[model samples]
Target: MREVAIVAFGQSDHVRDSAQTSEVEMLMPVLHDVLRRTGLRTRDIGFTCSGSSDYLAGRAFSFTMALDGVGAWPPISESHVETDGAWALYEAWVKLLTGEADTALVYAYGKSSPGDLREVLTRQLDPYYLAPLWPDSVALAALQAQALIDAGRTDEAELAAIADRDRTAAAAHPHAQRRGPRPAGEYVVAPLRTGDCPPIGDGAAAVILAAGDTARRLAAAQGRRPAWIRGLDHRIEAHSLGVRDLTDSPSTRLAAERAGVFRRPVDTAELHAPFTSQEVVLRDALALDDTVRINPSGGAQAANPVMATGLIRLGEAADRIQRGDSDRALAHATSGPCLQQNLVAVLEGEA
Candidate 1:
């Protein structure tokens, strides 16, 4: 595979609602900002990809409408996914590896406030067994949290501590929807408190990638370091939550191994764990220790925008390396209910 690096990242301010802003309106500035930061124009990009959901938009081909924001007038090679933006990044990386594109742009957004997000998420589950039950996203996650508690792997207090730490860290992120730690309270769902859950929000994130020499030149011209992609891999588990071990993330473990996460010590990790319990599962799956900082941007629990949350994890991890704050970092993204799918990427800065 050809070497690829993240050259620029941009995000919209996360909020519970964007009452007046259309999806294109929400995306335009973010798309422009990333291009501006990279000192590149839309025409310079060899490929463009995006991630979004029709369910969230309450319309089909919602991503097609977003193309207007990118100025598709001149016509650009683009593709989109129904999954998280991180997966879209994966697709762009593959294009680079094939030598089809030297530079690619990836972005994802979620305007979840327009509809019932819980009900919308249920559409992704098995229609016969899970969808008919309408368990909602939080309830499904609560089941996993309960299983972890019952197995003695974690407890409510520990979960609360994780929330406290993440929310506190979010206080520094201007784009985060929720910030400041509060005491964990009575369960929203058994064994899961409000703090244990992510704040539902509307947001967007974009990342720019360049392969090999293009990456080096871009970094030099921008006077910034590039987060080189050393390893990237993804894995999936059984779709049925009942058949899987809720407390252990075998898929995440496998992806981490394939992504070479344990090859060297990492200074930081930005995990797309929407819930506190999920964070615990990921930390163990990745074999990260106390020495490694986790979720310095507060993670999804602080501000989750569904499709965009996972990509934000990649952006946050890369930002740390680009800023010279860390030499090695790990970014994780997840999809499907109860952590059924996971993507892991290891990034390193120039020595």
Candidate 2:
């Protein structure tokens, strides 16, 4: 496989709603910023892939319309996923490894405020059983939280502390939607408070991936180190929530192992645990120690923009490495109810 590195990343200001802005409008700035930072023009990109959902846009082929932001006039090799942008990044990496593309542009965006996001997410559940019940995202996450409590994996106070810490860290992130200190509020769903759940937001993010010498040149021009992808893998579990253990994430553990997360010491991790209790499960699954810094950019708990949130985790971890803040890091992304699917990537700075 070819060595791949994230050379540039850019994101929009995460907000509760973008009633005045279209998805294309939200993406243009981020896309331009990423391309500009890499000193690459749209014509120079070998491949372009995006992540977005027509369900959120309330129309079919919504991503096709978003192509305007990337300027598809000259006709570029493009693809898209209905999943998070982190998965899109994985696809781009695969393309580079195949020697079909040496440089790729990846982006993801979501507008969750247009509809009842909690209700909308329930559609992703098992159609025969869980979908009929129409359990909102918060309620489903609360069920997982309660399971953790019952299994003695975590407590309410610990969950609150996690929420408190994440919100505090979010204060420094200009693009973070939720910031400042937050008192764990009354349960929106039993065992899950307002703070325990992620704030629904609208946002977009873009990343530029370059292989080998191109990556080195980009990093040098930017006067920073490249965050080389050491290992990358994803795994999925049973779709039926009833058959799965909510307090443990076997999928994450498998993905982490495949991604070489435990092969060496990690200095930081950016995890896509939207719910506070889910963070506890992921930490155990990844076997992260107290010495490893977690979610310094606040994580999805502070500002989750659905399809784009997972990609933000990867970008944040890479940014930390590029800035010389950490030598090695782990970036994780999750999908489906109770983390049924997971992607893990291990990144290391220049040796």
Candidate 3:
């Protein structure tokens, strides 16, 4: 298999509203920033992929307009996933492996504040049973939290601690929406609290991937270190809540093992734990220890723009490697209720 490395990454500042800008407008700066970092233009990319949901925007083909952000005048080879952006990254990586495209551009975005996010998420559940109940995302996560508490995997204080640390970390991130000190007290559900939930926000992110000599050239031009993607894989689990175990993410376990997450000690890890309780599930499923630095980017708990959040995790992990801060890292992304579907990517700095 051919090797692929992330040469550059960029994102828009996470915000609550973009009254003056469309999604394409929001993505233009990010796309330009990524291209500037690599000294490459849109025409230089061999392939382009995006992740987004039409349902989130209450419209179809929301990604079509966002293509303007990539300057599609000459038209570029592209694809999109209705799933999270991490899946789009997976598709792009596969395209690289085919020995076709030497470089690829991957991005994702969502303006989740446009609708009642809680009610919108209900559509993700089983239409006949769960959807009819209108089970919102936070409610499903709360169920997982209760199960974790019952299994003694976490307590109120642990959830608070995760929220505190993640918020503190977000303070350093210029694009992070939920930063600053959050009082770790009380519960929004029972174990989860208002402080623990991720902020609903709007944002876009882009990453450039290159292989072999092209990758080396781009890395040199950017004056940035490359984070080589060692292995990447994703898996999905049964969606039925009654039949599935909410306490552990079997999909994550499967994807991590496939991605070789345990091959070596990860200097840092970026897990996409949307809610505080999901953190426990991902931690156990990925087998990350205390030595692993988790969510240094504040993860989804800081600002989750739906389809974009997971891919942002990958970009954040790559950023750590590019900055000479990490030698080995793991980036994770999850979708579906209670972490039903998961993706894991193992990354390391190239010599």
lDDT of the structure predicted as candidate 3: 0.88
**TM-score for each prediction?**
0.98, 0.99, 0.98
In candidate 2, which residue ranges exceed 4 Å CA deviation?
none
Instruction: Give a tens-digit lDDT track for model 2, residues 1-351.
Output: 789999998999999999899999999999999888889999899999999888787788989888998889868899999999999999999999898998999999999988888888887887888889899988888999999999999999999888888889999999999987787888899999988999988999999999999999988889988889999999998878888999999999999999999989899999999899999999999999999999999999768999999999999999999999989999999988888899999998999
Better of 2 and 3 by TM-score: 2
The 0-to-1 C-alpha lDDT of every candidate, in the order given, reads: 0.92, 0.92, 0.88
Ranking by TM-score: 2, 1, 3
Worst 10 residues of 3 by lDDT: 184-193
In the predicted model 1, the residue pairs found to clash are: none
Q: How does candidate 2 fare on TM-score? A: 0.99
| Cα error, candidate 3, residue 162 (Å) | 0.4
Worst 10 residues of 2 by lDDT: 51-60
Candidate 1, residues 1-351, lDDT tens digits: the string is 789999889999999999899999999999999899888899999999999999998999888889998878778899999999999999999999899999999999999999999889999999998899898898999999999999998998899999999999999989989989987877888878888989988999999999998988887777889899998999999877889999999999899999899888899999998889999899999999999999999999778998999999999998888888989999999998889899999999987
Clashing pairs in 3: none
Q: Over the full model, what C-alpha lDDT does candidate 1 score relative to the true structure?
A: 0.92
RMSD of 3: 1.1
